[model samples]
Target chain A: MKGRLLPLYVVALYAFLHLPLLILCAFSFNSSRFTVWEGFSLVWYRMMWNDGALAEATWNSLLIAAVSTVLSTIVGTLCAYGLWKKNSKLLSGSLYLSLVTPEIITGIALLATFQWAFRYLQIQLGMHTVILAHVAFSIAYVVLVVMARLRTADPALEEAALDLGATEWQAFRLVTLPMLKPGIAAAALLAFTVSFDDYVITSLVAGVDSETLPMMLYAMARRGANPVVSAISTVIFVGLGMLIVASERLQKA
Target chain B: MKRLRALFLLPAWAFTLLLFLGPMLIIVAYSFQSKGIYGGVVEPWTLENYTRLFDPLYGVILLRSFVMAGAATAGCIVLAFPLALYIARSGTRKSLLLNLVMLPFWTSFLVRTYAWMFLLRDTGLLNSALLALGLIAEPLPLLYNDWAVIVGLIYGYLPFAVLPLYSNLERLDKSLFEAAADLGAKPWEAILHVILPLTAPGMRAAGVLVFIPCLGAYLTPDLLGGGKSMMIGNLVQNQFTSARDWPFGSALSLALMAIVMLLLWALLRRDGEELL
Candidate 1:
């Protein structure tokens, strides 16, 4: 805590965190198929752009993330609002459980549930299943983010609106909903990030026709370290990094 | 009006019940059934799945997963403590540092793991650099092992460890440090005796956050450990996939949930509800 060594250690720690990402980005431009330092080229980026399955996967990921984020944000905001009005220990407790539970278990449980239900429903794991799974897991995060904002908000505004001869719905819609927009936006951004980045759960519930971006990335990674994977990753890393920073700014605002 | 208020919770509750809780219940029931001759589940409602977990094959795996997850949790603490403290004490740079930490948390974890894979592979960046620098005669066998898995877990979960500790440190009484200094304690002594004791709860929270995920980690071990260093997660995955034994998979998952839930119960009892 007291030496020049501390500053150096902090720098090294940041290096450990950021250096791999920088390297991946840099190598993404390398022309060689292997890791050797070849001349700079956009070949991998072009290949990633041209890959048909990869394009479809990206579309699927976006669609899933968009739908799930909207669904979870609406549901979670309402749930958090209700809890704020009158706390339910059981409800909030389960939300915490969803957050803490590991992805593998959740993935398997949802998979099991889908398979069991399919016996009667006559459907297979597909985009709908993955979207539902995303909503199920992501509702907790949205609720937490919104609940944090709700706790800081003054409840008296809604009460004042109600006392002024407004209906309860009008009071909430006019007073509370306006105050919650930024939090809802932040939570929606977070939900989208979580849904898009999810691999394990998405993989389990996605049928062959519904592969998401992370599933495709996983397949490419498993095949070996290719420059195409690096290119795609660099794009995602930059995109999501901006999204998160924007969410933080929104939360602060 | 009260009933109308409850309607706000209806969608969330129905979604949770029909999807999350309902699936969990299905797995719990399946755990008590036996493996069907073909694949799924066939029930006389036997406890063989849980009993079979006592086999030494799984015992070794469960033990190894515990040790590796523990090692990763400890590593995250060691690496994150100073960083968290540094961030808590900094002024203008504090928010920037916090953003940097959360950046990886929001991005694709699979991409970051792939970054590590790109570095650690035999024909990868680390080996390529070392060979170029003449640091070694041959490439070190860095990937596809227990150490790789441990390192991956630590890297992936380090941000989770840092944020909790930082939040705790941010709330600490700065006067305590000053008092310790006024009482003639050196900086090291103040940190050891004063700061360390106060941050213990935060460390526990960080431990729970990191350890639970690390214990049930599938992708990290699967990609880094490479079929060799199998964790309990991988074993459970195998049962459902390649092994085609859903009942055993359910039992394994239940066993995992039990361990996680027990840990959560202890933490909640000790720390109230804020640990999440």
Candidate 2:
């Protein structure tokens, strides 16, 4: 990064990463009769709004993401807390396995388990199953991110709180929990975003009825690269960017 | 008190044990069981699924998956190490760059991937741009082949590699380079002798993170690899969906898990040694 090349290096990397996405956003509003851009217009965005099926899928995705984010955060915090106390090499390795294990393996394995177990429980797949799958991955991620944060937090602060007559839960709520807020917020947003965007695992585990945004987008893209899909992607991008900004603002507040 | 300390980890242990390890064990067992004609596990057990898993056609696929994953991992490391070094050198400004790297994620994975498909195809951006520049008389064949799949894979997994290496390089004992220089070692030699060895664990971590997932990657390869080239992931998917060979799919799933576990073990062992 010396002389003339430094800015060029940055430009090249940025272009490599974002050029396609910029093109997609540009075409989303394109007034053209085709996929390629003719001129900017909001017709496709209007079309996206009017599509009832797309609207329903959007609702499903939001609900799934919210429920999954909350569930995963709770479970992940508990799981990370549990692991933090133990601190055994053996347990650490096992925790890492959950993160490293491929989604397909977990998806199919859980499908088989659900098929066998839930038949008696009478649970046919739908939003619940999709949430469950999303939670599964989210919890692993939550555990990982929160654990990293927890490691940097001082154990003595909790001990001092306890020395001042705080109970374990009191120490946790008064000190540890407040300190870990940013990590939790980060983990929640990240988990929600990932779950909202997932396609393959959701496709495998979900029943016939649960068509998340990604599932719809995948079908649309597969059949043909429909122009409306660009509009949908634009909506997702702007919404996620807002959510991310809101999360950061929350952390600062 | 020690036992009480153990109690804290119960949730993590239980989560990993039940969801992670338990499902893995189930995959192993399910793979061995006979496929019931009605699309579930049969009463009888057999190695029929595992045997078919090793059939020449599938074997080629398994091999190709290794090659693709290896290529992707290499691609990630090459770009990641240099990029991470530069960013870490840039210090506080690095976070901005890191966030920008993650901006692709504001869009859906499907959308990001589809954008690549649109750009790399015959009449896509690179070809059109190149043709406009008269850099080439004909459009470059850039999409729907091994190279495109590799590009897509590297694109998806780059941040994973970069993050680990950045921190790893950033935390390096700066004095080590000074010591190497004092010992008359050239800058390259100093890096090779000190920095590379120190960052070996991070490199291994990045490799495992990138390679293992790349091996089982379903979307990038399927979308970009085209029907012509596929990995074990697509095969497993087919067995479950199109092929309707649940038993075979189960076996392949178990095989995939095994490969992941093995790599994880190797990585952790190396990481442990490196740390010590």
Candidate 3:
């Protein structure tokens, strides 16, 4: 009786977890303005496409996600590699601290720092600050993911490559690099998704001219139920869904 | 060779020092200074910002945030444990179930929160369906309350609770359950005496994992609670934005950080310095 009931409970919980998002996705295609469906249409999607601010936000989000992902992935992978080579309790502890820090605090801290520094430097918060902040927070995630991959990797293979007269760079490039490829790819995907989805931090640091997709989506969401918001959400939902699926496959590969 | 490996650590360390640690240190400094008349911090380092935290208004907000986060963490543990057990006990579908749990988490948090807003709004889907079914004359106040905020927090952090608990359950020795059974322990007794005690660490970890995020949650309360259920996250965001009180905001940030560090220190002491 217990065994039979447990699975049923699991199914119920999964339904609770997934049904709202699925319903939202379904309503994104509704023809009418209200929740009561009036048959399916692409009207809202059309509106999302035509919105100039949303288009600009999308461009900004993509640019930041792209640049920050590359930078964080490189830096984090190297840091993970370095840690693997020589363990530093202080550095690892700091990474964990950053990971566990609340997004609000991090956002404000960065905001305070920028406002203070920019006063002296005569600069302004914009896409540059957002990108910098994204990289800073994202590096911890990348390091954690890549470090998990490194722990599973055998050190003997690298030593063997060195014993066979290959240089340190050559061994890392030819052997370790190929092995780390999947982990690196997974880290990049994680970083991109995080940077793109970020609202609190991005909102705090973003200038008037640097709105991202999430910052825009949030404003629309706050105003109430707009099908245009749903339409954009569906786009992001499907887009990130595909990316996560790919990342999972890469990790398994 | 040693120097080459050190080179690999340079970029990350520099980034951390310049961006992460430096900014945090600046907040510490700002918290002691006075808020400028306009929007920035000024000289004359003082503890006025910290003393202002004693105000009843900020105290209520802090207490509310604490209670809401605690309630949400408890809800997540209750909901997550059964699901985690089922996933751990599953044979062929364990990985699939695990992936399913993580899928929603991987999606945009704003989209997920918006989904809840779409459901719980006055004229939203839930009310629409209930009204169509002759449930009530007026739409129930489903949105913009403490309850709605708690639901959102649980939903957002449920995955964080599940993964750790499932991992712990997976590593348990099955023979222990059989041993309990043979020793005259009933099913509930076996779970209470055997499984619960053994998996306490995992549950503790999950509690911290869920609690910390819920404590600092901004989007859920802001979007779902509609400013009715103000949290610490909202309080901090408000100071930086409309309040335009940088010193006060910095002080609030430090207070929040201190609470977090207290929790982390407790967890680390129990787990012996390894963070998952």
Candidate 4:
């Protein structure tokens, strides 16, 4: 029973999990507009290449993600630093507070404040605001990941630098930063990916003109079921798959 | 020197307060206010928002979301436990396969969700396959309903449940199982007396990790519900976009958070950690 049931269970679980995604991949290549498998074609790929809205949205998404990643990384690294040096109760509690809060709560709270409190603050509710929201949430996640790395990190290396007459800034730049590179890289990748994928937070914060790919995709999805969504899904899967593979290799190295 | 440390932390602290806590404080305050005629929070305290939310129409939807979220969490635990055990048994190969499992998580959640409609809709992938197999005369009603939501929740959260259980199971003491067997305990007893107790914390962690998020999920239901009903997340969404009632939305959100806290307290009463 053990031997017979084991692979049966694993295969069954993963099949049930991924069967939908596989359909999405297969249907993306289907030539006919209908979802049923038609003669295969690369027309969707060609269309994606020429689509101006998608082209512009792609650039906007990349810019938002990059900006959020860098900003979140710096703030996160310092927050991780303060939390590390003291491990004080207040810092630790607040850190865990944001980490555990539901994304919806955070999203709505920020939305109400942005559209209400800061409504007259004169900041345009566009790319700038979306990036700010992304960075806020992304910083929490990045801090958590980097803090875990910092926990097992030997501080002696930094101390050694200080012992050799390196200033605090010099010690961090040369010694701590190098050792923290893998952790920082992982944090950046995570921050970027999440910022890229986010819909709820961005939707509430993004201006009418500053549409991320996800918001656009969400509109297409909710308005009606379209096979074009499948094509978009396939492209994202391939793109993110490459990123994941690349990151995993980098992390291992 | 301490002030210097504070300087490094200033940016995050300020943003989290302004963006995170400040808005949350607004939500908390709004929850107690009256809804304006024009669909915003009125500048006065009233229990109208909270009372309005509990009306039967909204209550039914809340009940539906709870039932669905509970079913999803239970299903995920059942599916993930054995899978985690098998992966734990695989030793070195476990990490690589596990990495494969987490690969989709790096992709956009929107795409993964839409992927479900591709497989679950009538005349979609699974139905077509079933018809081809000559097993069913018709396609299954798999999409835009409870089952679709369940599938999405499990698919989205399964990796979370699996990774925790695998680590907990891997850390189990083999000697205890050996001793149980030596005492003539059957396989079932070995699992119950030795394995289950040892790894119960994994279940607790897995359950909380999946349940709390599932409770607030909007997209899965909105995309898959097909107007079957509204959920807590959907209610909040509608409050902003359609209802235009921010005060009521805030009230509903606060109640949802309270429900989450109550559930956490209830779950912690059965601390799986102490099971060992």
* Stretches > 4 Å off in candidate 2: A1-7, A88-92, A245-253, B1-18, B105-107, B127-141, B173-199, B273-276
lDDT of 3 by residue, A27-59 (tens): 999999999999999999999999888999999
TM-score of chain B of 3: 0.97
All DockQ scores: 0.77, 0.51, 0.84, 0.64
lDDT of 1 at A228: 96
Q: Candidates ranked by DockQ, best first?
A: 3, 1, 4, 2
lDDT of 3 by residue, B1-276 (tens): 588688899998998898889999999998899878887888999999999998999999999999999999999999999899889888899989999999999999999999999999998999999999998899999999999999999999999999989989998998999999999999788989999999888898999989999999999999999999999999999998999988898899899989898988898799754334
- The whole-model C-alpha lDDT of candidate 3 against the native structure comes to 0.91
Off by more than 4 A, model 4: A249-253, B130-140, B261-276
What local distance difference test score does each model get?
Answer: 0.91, 0.79, 0.91, 0.80
Candidate 2, residues A107-218, lDDT tens digits: the string is 7877776676576788788888888778877787787778878888888988899799988877777888888888888889878888898888888878877898999988
Candidate 4 clashes between residue pairs 3 or more apart in a chain or in different chains: none
Q: Give the TM-score of candidate 3.
A: 0.98
What local lDDT does model 3 show for residue B142? 96
lDDT of the structure predicted as candidate 4: 0.80
User: Which candidate model has the greater lDDT, 2 or 4?
Assistant: 4
- Candidate 2 deviates by what RMSD? 3.2
DockQ of 2: 0.51
**Native interface contacts retained, candidate 3:** 0.79
i-RMS values of the candidates, in order?
1.1, 2.9, 0.9, 1.9
